[model samples]
Target chain A: MSGGKLITGFAVTATSHTLGEYRARGGYQALERALLGMKPEEVTGEITASGLQGRGGAAFPVGRKWSVIRPDDGETHYLCANADEGEPGTFKDRWVLENAPHLLLEAMLIASYALGVRHSFVYIRGEFDLAYRRLAGAVEEAYGAGLFGKDIFGSGFSCDVFVVRGAGSYVCGEASALITSIEGKKGYPRNRPPRLTVRGLYQKPTVINNVETLANIPWIIAHGAQAYRTFGTTKSPGTRLVSVSGHVTRPGVYEVEHGYPVGRFIHEDCGGVLGGRALKAVIPGGISTKVLTASEIEPHRLGHFGDCEDRRVLPQSAGIPHLEPLVFEGESLQAAGSSLGSGGMIVIAEGTCMVRVLQVMLRFYHHESCGQCTPCREGMGWLHRIVDRIVSGRGRPEDVDRLYEISRANDGTTICGLGDAAGYATVGILDKFRCEFEYFIAHGRSRYDGCLECLGSS
Target chain B: MKHLIPECEALKARLPQGFESTLVLPCLRRVQEERGYVADGDIDALAQYLGVPRVQIEEVLSFYTQFRRQPIGRWHLQACHNVSCSLRGAGSLLDRLRERLGIEPGQTTPDGRFTLSTVECLGSCGTAPVLVVNEVYHESMTPEKLDALLEGLE
Candidate 1:
């Protein structure tokens, strides 16, 4: 609401997904500009100058990611746009995939040209029927219009984009796991050291980007780096498409600049909590982020968790204390022990029990674990069982400590970030709402009078 | 093995000859789509058709939760029981479903008309309390609306 519409401009148009409508809006012009006038390196340079970062959970610099690719190294390179929006409370990518399919394709074309990728894949979630249908249609339209395949735009650069549907695996959102899924295997993440950049997707150099991250490519190409940086903060620049849901009166996707406040986002943009109820807590990013209380929501701070010494621990250590706290919409959600992951702000109204929230989160992580690592596979289920007991009024006071210990041990013990996500998801809730767990153990009921039955028992 | 399903020939003809293990997931999906669910015989037939090891094909089948190993009823109701949906009374909605259908989560009615289950998240949290019946999403689900949806579904 605060920033001008960059990505979601065509969301309301009924025929926005069509290539005709997209071309009418000057869609593939960025590809033409990059392919005809500028060199691939120049395109990557512009993106690096724009200070664009991945809009996915990990905010790695997008241009830097492209800069790492050895385009002319004679080895086949692949690019994948991660469209598996499986993260709970995050649906912004779905919006782009459904409404602006060609924008993503056009962006993919520019990115593939820059990265020297011949064949690319959009690994979309199978559940997103509309996105798949529209994207498949868009790809066909591009192929037919001479926009894709065999020296596109007569620029001597050829790239083919394929849409690979994922079969309901949350772990596939991770890059390596997605590659594995594309190879027709279980979506288990491989250990690093041989990063996906080096050997990925059938043992070739690969670049996996988020759908929203790729969508920004054409805009940056058309408008230039300086114009792109004018919207967001210096450190984390550009307008972000946030999906605000849960307890909000007007719950949907909103495009806002980096410095916008979290409170205003919930109050002004989202029309506050449903039925004008008092706000209890907000999960600034997705369910993976720790829940932020109403008071903490006033200063919505945003920062990449990568900068910290330990992302699992809150009140970021003195690793870079001198650096000014990166502001997300004018507030520090991080300072309050949370993050703006995937821009999925889930607002919790009053009368909701914190114990129930933790239970649901733990259960999700438990179900999604790929069973590759001992700590995450076993530890997640253990944590879920402990929370399940506490919610059912069969919990011991020691169960809370057990939950914290399990989470702490699970952090950073797996090949992928899913383990850290599981640990952080539970530990943050416990740190913020220990009282709710205590009350449940003592009085055999949630502080907010939630259902005492173990919802996580199944 | 019994004759492969009719779609199996078309799926096989589309393949680039020989067995490409990468096509296992897509083949299984197609088999499941043509037929309601991937039965054991179908797995054997697909393994024979694709020349893939039955164990390997089974691994793919078990890895993804979407590939139904057993037959599903006409109305396969999956409700989101994650945080957002749970906050919006998914628990009670789930309970109401159990009461109306006379089956717990993951159980099918004796009549084979309804099979109820729960999922982590449908990614439709904005419209919390979302329910998916046969891959079609029904958002903002309530007891009354669920009853009406079921009534209209057959």
Candidate 2:
């Protein structure tokens, strides 16, 4: 709440997306300064010092990722801008694509130079038409202005950026799957002992970073590391774009610094729940993360890792509308089983059935599973079928334990993280809402009929 | 062997070097866009153009849900029936569409004007119960709106 915008400062302005308007707002200055003044190593150094984490739910250090690319290994180096944001309830990447396409271009330029990548690809989601159009226009403008192609701005660094559209698959967002998709395959994830850093596109060194993470690079390079560090907590030192939706009165994307309280994000930023309904649950991240009960989230506490050693105590600025920073007092949501995955904050109000929610989420996993591993392919369908049975009138009493057992079995057995994601989603939902599942099994109806009763409950 | 489609040859020529494998998804998309579905003839033509096996091409086509092997209706209605949309009553909407259209999700109407399919999340959760009709998104959909949309389609 107290932090200023770094990545999205130009999003709300009346400026057109032309290079002229972007230049007027101090845009591309970072790319210019980094290209002219700083060494490639220094650019990576500044990023590492800033403690910027990957915004694509992994939270890995951005600098460390850039550092690993063996740019001088005598092999072709490729950089992939992971814009294929397919996680449910996450659309923050679309903002940069729709509003500030040049930011991404500039960031890509800096990243390509730092990583020694000559060819790059923006693997965007297929549904993002406006983003694709805007980015295509920006790439054209950059090439026309000599920001791309041979001898960019007289820096002698040449890179070509291509925007690739994903056909339609959530699993393609995974790094390996994205690589496979780029290779014109079926988007099935490859087993990873040889990570993309070593052998990627065209069997070359590749570095894939999220769209939001790359957007932050221009800011860190333009502003010094210390200046960038002043925004958020020490460990998570950046403003994150949180997409808050579902049952909130004013659901949209809000750019809040890391360690901002989740309760404040809901009550203050999102205008609280719709119809003044009592909060039942909150999916703090995307649907892939565990759901947290309303009572589990402490009010005015910045959502951060509680048991993890990376906890930072934030200060309560004047008029910031929060209590003392949500410190690592005890076991927190991460300890209770959840993560800040992709910052897709979905607030669930009272009268929404947890069993129904799990069923819906499981259906998505079942549909999106690539069928590579048997455990995930079979387990997701089993979990979905069992949940569907429970939601309907034909659920057996033993189905709850069966659901838990299947979910546990599928967690770590797949070649990709989709298996773990599909398995772990049942943890918090079943743990917090066991009574709802029991209610559905006993009475053949939901404890709350918030949506509809069309699933054969009668 | 059937004659190769001219569009497939043109698309193959347009692809960048070393990106031959990357042509499958985009080529399939293009074929679907022009022909309404990926005909078997296009696959054979692509196999010839890209020099990949025909079974290999079929395998790629079968993996992604967006590709269709047969013809579809003029207006393909892809309703987001995933978690976010379902939480907002996308199920009831789907049921209404099914009842009105008198066909299942994978089936097209006899008149070939509409085809309904329930898809995963479309990344438009802010506007839940979203419907994507022929690549254009119609969000925050309701029963009346669906009826009006169906009426306006034909």
Best by TM-score: 1
Evaluated at residue A192, the lDDT of candidate 1 is 86
The deviation in Å at residue A457 for candidate 1 is 30
Best by lDDT: 1
Tens-digit lDDT string for candidate 2 (A58-100): 8888888888875566667888999898899887888888778
DockQ of each: 0.46, 0.47
Cα error, candidate 1, residue A453 (Å)? 15
* Candidate 1 Cα errors over 4 Å, as ranges: A299-331, A451-458, B1-19, B48-52
Best by DockQ: 2
Q: Chain A in model 1: its TM-score? A: 0.92
> Residue A199 in candidate 2 has what lDDT?
79
RMSD of 1: 5.3
What tens-digit string does per-residue lDDT give for candidate 2 at B22-78?
A: 777777777777788888778877887777778877887888788888888999999
The true-versus-predicted C-alpha distance at residue A48 of model 2, in Å, is 0.9
- Candidate 1 positional error at A202, Å: 0.5
